[model samples]
Target: MADVETLHAIADAAASLQVLIQDAIEWKRQHLTDDLLSALIAAEDEGDALTADEMGEQVALLYLAGHETTVNLVGNAVLALLRHPDQLELLRRDPGLDAVAMEEFLRFDSPVQMSRRITLDELTLGDKTIEPGAFVVLGLASSNRDPRHFGPSADRLDLGRVDAGDHLSFGGGHHYCLGAALAKLEGQTAVGRLARRFERIELAGEPVYNGRINLRGLASLPLAVG
Candidate 1:
């Protein structure tokens, strides 16, 4: 447990990082380059360039999405594999199952548990009628385990499951995750490489959760690998 002072320090550090990201966005706007930041800065639709604040927000989102989400994805996948040895052994036996295994890992334990959305207009979903501007929170993790979509054994991890890619771990529609492909590649490579390099991998002690309500991942995972 972190003390009040430590919590304050963490908050301050996060604020500082936000400032730095905004500064970088402004810097990139002036000195346009071929990188992602420059591309976002210079992006225009029908000669309508993005506002400075919009650019900053987009850049910040890209940074966090590219870094934290992928870290959590890998961590959650490794933890899931550790918990399910049979699945781990199956993956170890067939390295070619990396892609599908990645999908199962994502479905079994989504890094992002929820997403918030605002109603654009009055909408009726099932029994509930949501008015315009109403706030809606989607439970992505729960959706992944939905028996209607994933069948009766949805709770179980099956690397060979074909419909595992249908999971909403990467979101859907226009607001889908921008770094989805990159994240998947990173996760596949990390899990596959770790399994290939380690003949025996076991948990050294109990894993510690990050304690974040939205993001699910391990704060520290002790592993014994040979």
Candidate 2:
């Protein structure tokens, strides 16, 4: 069936990406004596060392955490702009708003829609008790739309919002994304340039979405620009 093939294709793609990341990490470990790789190597105790397979998995996770997050940021930003004309025009005037704009954009349409975590022990959130081994799925997008955080205009795209970064798009606390700065820079560069150059940029047709609920993004966006 096509469905089974598609599932296999997705798995194959993930596996391929993992291999690529593994290869790069291995190459660097072989050549470079940098602190990051060195630290990873140093973490190994005398009795326990990082096996080849373990190292590969670690490197793969690192690559996805860094690479996939940025890809989503840019893709989601473009989709947001295409849908909101007023915000796009406003951004064209003030290039400096790129940073805040990205924050707002991320809040409005978070690239990674959901995150999962297992409670270490019995925990109480509000009135409910989360038992150990319970899986919790936090909806980042829904939280961004929370009236308490952004007030009544949470759903509205306000580029000049004072505290747009208050959203949990990049998450919070110790688990916060490591490559946040790099991702922000890339988004700012791309969006800022596009704003300055294009006199008129509009979607040519209905944009195709990736159809993955966890990753709300575009597969292909047909746009007309002048």
| lDDT to native, each model | 0.87, 0.81
Per TM-score, the best of the predicted structures is: 1
In model 1, the runs with Cα more than 4 Å from the true position are 1-11, 22-34, 44-48, 51-53
lDDT of 1: 0.87
TM-score (C-alpha) between model 2 and the true structure: 0.85
RMSD of each predicted structure: 3.1, 2.9
Regions more than 4 Å wrong, model 2: 1-19, 30-49
Q: Candidate 2 residues 74-145, lDDT tens each?
A: 777877877787888889999888999988988988888888888889999899999999999999889999
| Residue-level error in angstroms, candidate 1, position 119 | 1.5
Give lDDT tens digits, candidate 1, residues 1-226: 8999999999898778779988876676689867777666556423566776666567677888788888998989998888889988998999899999999999999999999899999998899899999889999999999999999999998998999998998888889988888899999999989988899999999999999988898899999999
Residue 6 shift from truth in candidate 2, angstroms = 4.7
